[model samples]
Target: MSQPKARRSQLISTYGIGGLFPSSTTSYMIAGLHEWKEDRAEPLSEPRLARSLKVVALKQPPAGGRKDVPVIRFPYTQVCPSCRRIGRLHELSKDWNIAECSKDKQPLNPFRLILACRRGHIDEFPYFQWLHRGQGKAGSDHLMKLEARGRTSSLADLVLTCTCGVENRNLDGAIGPLADFGTCRGSRPWLGPETEACEEIPRVLQRGASNVWYPAVRSSISIPPYSEALSKFVDRHWPLLADREVVTPALLARVAELSDGKYSVDQIVAELDRRRGEEQEEDDLSEARLRSGEYSALIEGRDEEDIDADFVCLPRDVPADFDRLITDVRKVTRLREVRALYGFSRLEGAGGSESNLCPLAPTHTNWLPAIQVIGEGIFMAFDRDELARWADKSFAKDRARMLKVAADRNAEEYGHAPKHIDIVEVAIHTLAHVIIDQLSLDAGYPAAALRERLYVDDNMAGLLIYTASSDSAGSLGGVAAMAETDRLGNALAEGLVRLSWCSSDPVCIESKGAGSDALNLAACHACVLVPETSCEKSNSFLDRALLFGTRDGGNESEGIFSHFVASAVGA
Candidate 1:
């Protein structure tokens, strides 16, 4: 069969291993990492990412190679469009060459519904079991058919029938908790011929449901020291030094000699030491630590003579009009972001339990799939002292407590970890959304293409609005250009103005809570919410009321930027 093409980045984000994609003929799931031909894939060096994921190395997905990613046909049951007869694809077809109706020769369509469990096991729907309902034994001889009575486009109109004279069943009760699809067989088809014993009940889902596949991706921005030439050179040659029992002066001298005097022996030795120190500093790296490194780099800025370094930032003056609210601005003219996929889960959100996450390969693999995107961005730091005072306000605490209550309830209901809600984080996050919405219009990038990175904690108050693309070597400076005093001031002003009044006003702003699980307050699609891809927290914990205070009858509570907005309006 001819293989379909996918972008190298998509293999990690959209269609990584075990992910299902549709071809012209049928749908197929990407095979496990064990099936991938490593030679066709290029090696990617991202030590921080490897350490965070606890993997030895990373590799870019193969594209335009002699061999491509392997795939296995999914939802093996194929239904004849003409006769409505349903059976396994292998049984319906005479051989691998043909996949059409055996009797009518009509093209076959894959059964839309499949079974999955919280544990990430998936299997074809138990058709024989459902058709027989345990009344009698079912076998290959008993032909089954799926008939859709075109009366209404509902599952109730869809019927599954068997030739054994058992009572037919409709698909009405086949999808939810009441589903009798039976226990999961723990099938790991992507890894090939693997099935385990599972006791969890399987839920029926459409083949293309969003919850069917959620790739747990971890990303880090290449910053300072790490982005420098000498550091990168060490990263490339570390495997050589790493294999040795010890890095002696002789080995260091040889490595420096191989550089042909481009780097001094002292510089190489220092870079290697730094790398080793970072590895030894922590056994498990956290996301906060990764962002902390990037935050420091952006704040200090970097102007390298090499010009080809992965990261280059130039500090810019804060817009005069918004200087009180904004502290610093950095124009990141060049940046590289590395994203690696560690594992994936089915029927769960990105924060599912580690035990439930399916393996990328049949066994432990040292390398993971990753991709790097180069781009530019505008990083703006808020006045931390001012933010701290604002977060201490009674109204800010109340609003934050409300959102925290919602988040805690959501966590309890969903069985996920409770979210840590900081009033400063909420305001900064909402500000990031409003600014991203404005930057989308001014920066020449769609909201989806633009992404936000929030730096809000006890010590840091900032956000980075950046656009990265794997297809381009670097960005066109649209985002970074907006960091200029005049453009950025206008963008911030316009963003504040836009947030002052949502189109869904009163109802939207007055609401105690809104959005998924009521985890948001005074925020919705009509106002602060951006594309899922653009947001870090899935558009949760946002409250425009926190940015521009809310009024209830005679009482008004001031927000973080309420004074700025009031002064701008000459109130």
Candidate 2:
């Protein structure tokens, strides 16, 4: 009792979610940060206090304008569970360059939009941007369609706030989901916690409540000297456009000071002017400063420090070393500590070409087992059937009682309740993985044979049991895999690791398949990316992921790439 309770307790506390559980052992999820402060709240923005007003979206605040921190309407609460929708509302820097989307030149990572809540009706539609990264039009008016709808019932949208009381007008971009809390008369085990299910999400959001939210990396490159310099120039010149009025020589001096004599005031001003002029035309803002006296001060290229290459964007007179320093600094700290934990950085390849920034792999935690069963491919085919029979009402009753206590204690008035779907999913995957490894070991399958027969054989299957399905929410499946839910898989992988290093059976990665995971050389770990591939796209979500096969889009299928196959030939 203590061990199981302790494990669940560990999960809840790790997330700092007191409002989610019926007791310490009942694991519940959280949304915002751990606390809320009044200062972070906006003064009830009047972005829509009009009978008729035109709105526009921006990748960043217009050049030289005041800090109009651009906002995207990514739903932290996934309005639609399965698909390749882009409306996760994540942020894109204002400086990223790409050919316009309208020209059929793909905007990197462009996603479609789904599900819009207007009044009580949910008008779900898919929206795609037809422009370049920073060179496209924003659908501000598009979101207004939702706001125009009447208010919702108790469980509906209202004020949205961060744990720090920083009111995020739209949902934070796509949050990796952890578990589901379905509607119910009471709580259940799988969803973890039960407290405060009655409370409306938006209301709790306004006060900065937590729900399965993971901090994500927000700023990707494009900071430092150029951003700082332009910030100053915009402040001094574009008073109305700046986030704060009164950008002065002091701000410009700060930017220059940091540049180490690599950038000049003149260069900074010109870059801002060039970019600003183009964007302002869309919003119809005047860019008279280009020809006004403001342009006079930037005539000479005065000395500024070196700009770091990692932050290199529309480069100014900044030097090469500046970029190096930024690269070093990024590895240690998150750019936007609250919103994101990592960024997409370019690393130099052996060929010396830039490679995409790789996301760090997730690790297993206390409840997570080190291994899982093997030989469970056939079992997955029975998932829809097996789950139906495994819904134990007796266990659910205990789970519900525990959950109700949580709701009462947390003071929640509205929200979805816990569901048993996850429990069955977890149980089956865990059982399958365990059985596979055990069966293989008992049959005296050598480590090499185990790899071939259990891991790679088409008829032979294994589960990345702890991992989330392609459509899973809240840090996706990484959270579960880290929890060590599958025992058999963990054990088998361990046995293989020992034998392979001894040179008995070389445990290279799988390469011949379509839906597989890739092994990281440096970390010596196999990682799976979901909904990122085409094969992993489910039958129900086929149209949603819009997966193109090797013939159509590119990859095998759409969904999480659980079956990792490396690029180099012959394992």
Candidate 3:
């Protein structure tokens, strides 16, 4: 969420969603969601979700563990100060990481130049254009050298020359609007032979800078496992289902006839009916399901037998305050999640057009880089009556208004406002962060692995925080174990206590608006914010005061967890 300065391409191996794989480190495009759908025609027994679904090269898993991924390193740009000779130090050594520059037995220094554009196009400094400038005298075999004139490291002091001894332009004014790098070659070396078309003029960027690269990622939760056996069967038999034009009764009968006893028409019709019903339910605003069908599971669903089980509710002895505020606590032992990587943006903030996923080639490509993670989580459903009453309060309304204004302004700038979560969601999200921070200390899991999934809509208000990984087998029971009745009560108390008084309190509690976009009211890095991976909203719309109280004159009475705080003191 926080765009800290660092070498982006290098760090992806260690921190990307698909954890440190070779493809993630260098490439911009990862697999998309739709690509992961059933593709059985390839004749592979076990599915290869990452490779077969991608557009470019097959992203094979590393043969070994972390040791397998090649160390991310680049050769130094060697330049001759006396003769204006320019080349990569790799020419002197076999390994680029350890290479040094030597020309005429004299050691050469590295060039501090790189080229990039506002459109996210990046490339090497155009030494050829800087030295030759379309002149016929210099040929491919010409020896190039570079010279720096003064002690002050300025571009004007840097000079370029060739073996031909022709006068070459100094590095001065080389980065201006009129200076030449030529029409961007649209090169994407990261994708291994892939290229793109870009008309942007390239600019200068120091190597290993944070602005060099930024990734765009989106995620979704797997809900209810398709809700029928026949639907699942059809999905698996996509080859048989692929050519079907529509899902009408006649088509189902024809498909059943064609299946030759593989599938029954009655079962197919039932499955189609179930799907249509679900779609209709989605359109009906009165019963709009919350994102991921989590509301359905929270309201009425039983646990399944295995790790991919949909929902399991465990009744627990809630604290007096919790009894008044929370309606149910469900320990979700297993859930499916789909994450897609569409495209990337550079320099500017990451709000690319939604249409960037169009086919790069003439023919269709069913592949996109994707990985599946199975994780366990805890879901807490707030008491609808209590939340509705709170929403009616003037203070809550005013607070929501403040957030709405901030959201509107953000939408104007970013082209889309964050999905508006009301006061109840704000309270739930703030509490979620509070719990995540405390859980990291006690749950034996890093905050990075513990992610938050918010469910807030007109009909439902809930929060689910879980541990997910790209690894085939998901997390240990470190996070989900905290959902035990006594353990959860204790963790809830501890989290509430932590939020009652932040280390940056007074300032942290009092601030009306703080954080990256001024989107937060009373939250700060000292307390409320967690790692970007854990939060859905990028740590926005958070306010500790909503859970506790404002700094100036607010007290426990003004907050949602006032009863909890009071009961904890009584104990």
Best by lDDT: 1
Stretches of candidate 2 above 4 Å error? Answer: 1-245, 248-262, 278-307, 311-571
Residue 34 shift from truth in candidate 2, angstroms: 9.5
Ten contiguous residues with the weakest lDDT in model 1: 552-561
Please, what are the lDDT tens digits per residue for candidate 1 over residues 319-413?
88788888889998888899899889988777736678889888899899999988899999988998888788788888889988998888888
List the candidate 1 regions with Cα displacement exceeding 4 Å. Answer: 96-98, 134-141, 151-153, 178-181, 244-261, 264-266, 471-474, 553-557
TM-score of each: 0.93, 0.22, 0.67
Superposed Cα deviation of residue 370, candidate 2 (Å)? 30
Backbone clashes in candidate 2 total 100
lDDT of 3 by residue, 1-571 (tens): 1112222222232223211122211222222222222232122111112222333211222222322322222213555444446776676434454433343544444556666655555466777567777676744566666766777777787778777756776887765442454676664433334557878666676554554555555445555544223444554444444443644667677767765786798877665556456545544422123353556765564555434343344444555557788777777666655453434555444443333223322244544333346687787888867888977877677778887878777767755445464888898999999989988988888888888988876777888888777543256877778877788888898888767887897888777678866789889988989998788777888988788766455454678887678667778
The candidate with the higher lDDT, 1 or 2, is 1
Query: CA lDDT of each candidate?
Result: 0.84, 0.23, 0.59
Rank candidates by lDDT, best first: 1, 3, 2
Q: Model 3: how far is 83 from its true place, Å?
A: 11
Sort every candidate by TM-score, greatest first: 1, 3, 2
- Model 3 misplaced stretches (Cα beyond 4 Å): 1-120, 123-212, 227-234, 244-292, 305-318, 348-364, 392-394, 401-421, 471-474
Cα error, residue 444 of model 1, in Å, equals 1.9
